[model samples]
Target chain A: MSDIRFQCIKVEQLDDIHVVRFADDKVMDPARIEQLGGELQRLSDSSESPKVIINFSDVKFFSSAAINKLIVLEKRVRAKGGRMRLTNLRPEVRDLFGFTQLDSLFSIHDQQSDAVVELTTK
Target chain B: MPADADWIWKIDQEIPSRAEVACGLIRDFVEKLEDAGWNEALVFAIHMALEESIMNAIKHGNANDESKLVRIVAGFTASLFQATVTDEGEGFNPADVADPTLDENLEITSGRGVMLIRQFMDDVEYSQGGRKILMRKHRG
Candidate 1:
C-alpha cells in the first residue's frame, strides 16, 4: 500500500509485509551494496517486529560482498524480533548460498507469493 | 577469440586498485567469453569468481588505496578459463580465515569472498602469502 525508495532497492508494502526488490540486475558494487544494507536496516528498524520479504526476481548477479550485506541485514532483522524471507533467487545466487551453508540459516522460497503467504499466515 | 582454439583472448595488466577499474576488467572478460559462445552457466561462474577475486584484491588487499595497483593476467579457451590476481598490500594467511559456514560464523558479514572463489573455480591456489591468487575453471 506504500512505497519507499532507495538507490539500489525498491520497496513496496503489501499490508504488514514489505516486499523488497533490487533495482539493479547485478548487485555487485561494494559501496552501493553498503547503501542497500543501510536502507534495509532502516526499514527493519522502522517498525516493531517488521515482516520483510526480499524478492530477488531482478537480480541476475551479485558479488560475495553483497551476500555479506544480506547476512548483516538478517542479523539486524532478527535482533529486532522481525522476520525476513528471501524469494525468487536465481540459481547461481542460490547455489552460492548453499555452498556457504547459509541456506539453513535463512528462509528461502522459490516464489514471492509463497513467502508472503508464509509470513502472513505466521 | 576463436571457438575451437586452445586459448583465445588473453591479457596482462596492472591497474589502479579501484572498484571501477576492477569492474571494467571483469566486463571485458565476460564479453570475451560471451563472444566465444560460452554457455550461460559457465559464464556466470567465471564472472562471479573473477569478480570476487579482483574485488578482494582491491578492497581487502589494497584497502582501497588508489595508488596501489592490482596485477591481473587472464586467458581463456572455449573450455577453460584461468586468471591470477596479485595485490600490493601485505597478505594474510588463507588458513587463518574462519569458515563462514560454521554456525558460530554464519552471521558474519565478511570472509565469504575467498570461499566463493574456491567454490566456483576448479583450481585455486594462494601464493606470495595470500597476496596472489591463481584460479582456473573448466567449462561444462
Candidate 2:
C-alpha cells in the first residue's frame, strides 16, 4: 500500500468555459478518478455557470469509477446552474461512452477549443 | 516472463486506502505485457479492465473489508488477454442495476462500472453468483 500517485488536473478559463485537463497520459485508475472528483467538486460548488469542457486528450483509458465521478460532477454542475460537456475523447473512449450510452447524456465534441466555442455560444 | 506462466495474486486488503496498491501491481503486469505482443491499445484495455474489476472486487464485493481476500489471476495469449477477480462477499444480481443510459438514471453513479466493463472488454461474464467476474479482450 505504499505506492500512490496523483495525476495533476489543471483547470484553465477559456472565456466563460472552464477547460479541465488531466496531467496523466492515461487516467483509468480509481485513485486518479477520486482526485479529479475533488477538483470537480470544488469547481462545481464555486462557479455559478461553469461551462466546463473536460479535456481528455491525454487520457487514453478510464474505468467505470471515472464515469461515476463524471456523473456526480454533472449532477453537481446542474445543481449550480452550470452547463458541462466533454471533448477530445480518444476513439476508444468514445466507443466506451457509446456502449454505455453515456454519450447521449453529455454533449461531446471533437476538440477542446471547439467545445469552448460551442459552450460560450450556447 | 514467458506467455506460459499465469500471474496470480491475493488481495487481502480494503479499498480506497489500498486501491493504489492493487493498481500498481496491475500496472507492472501491463508493463510486462509488451513482451507478450500486447500493444499500447491492448495494454490500455487490459489495464482499465483489471482496475475496474479489482475495484469492484474489493469495494462492492468485499464491502471494503480488509479481512476478506480478493483472488486475481491474469494471463495473455498471442491474440487474447484474460483476467478474473473473485471476492469473498455476497454478490448482487447484474440485472438489478438500471441501464445508465436511461434518461432517469443518467445521474446515477453505480451502473457505470458494469457498463464500462462490458464496453472495454471483448467478453464479460459473471459467475459464482456474481462474486467473480471474468473478462477478455482480443487484440486488433
Task: Give lDDT tens digits, candidate 1, residues B91-120.
Answer: 989999899999998888888888888888
Query: Which digits, one per residue and each the tens of the lDDT, describe model 2 over residues B1-140?
Result: 32454433222333332576677777777777866667776777777788878888888888888777788877776666777788888997888878877888877777667767776799999999999888888767
Which regions of candidate 2 are displaced past 4 Å? Answer: A1-7, B1-17, B35-37
For model 1, which pairs clash? A1-A13
TM-score top scorer: 1
Q: Global lDDT of each model?
A: 0.86, 0.75
Q: Give the lowest summed-lDDT range of ten residues in model 2 chain A.
A: A1-10
Q: What is the lDDT of residue A57 in candidate 1?
A: 85
Best by lDDT: 1
Global lDDT of model 2: 0.75
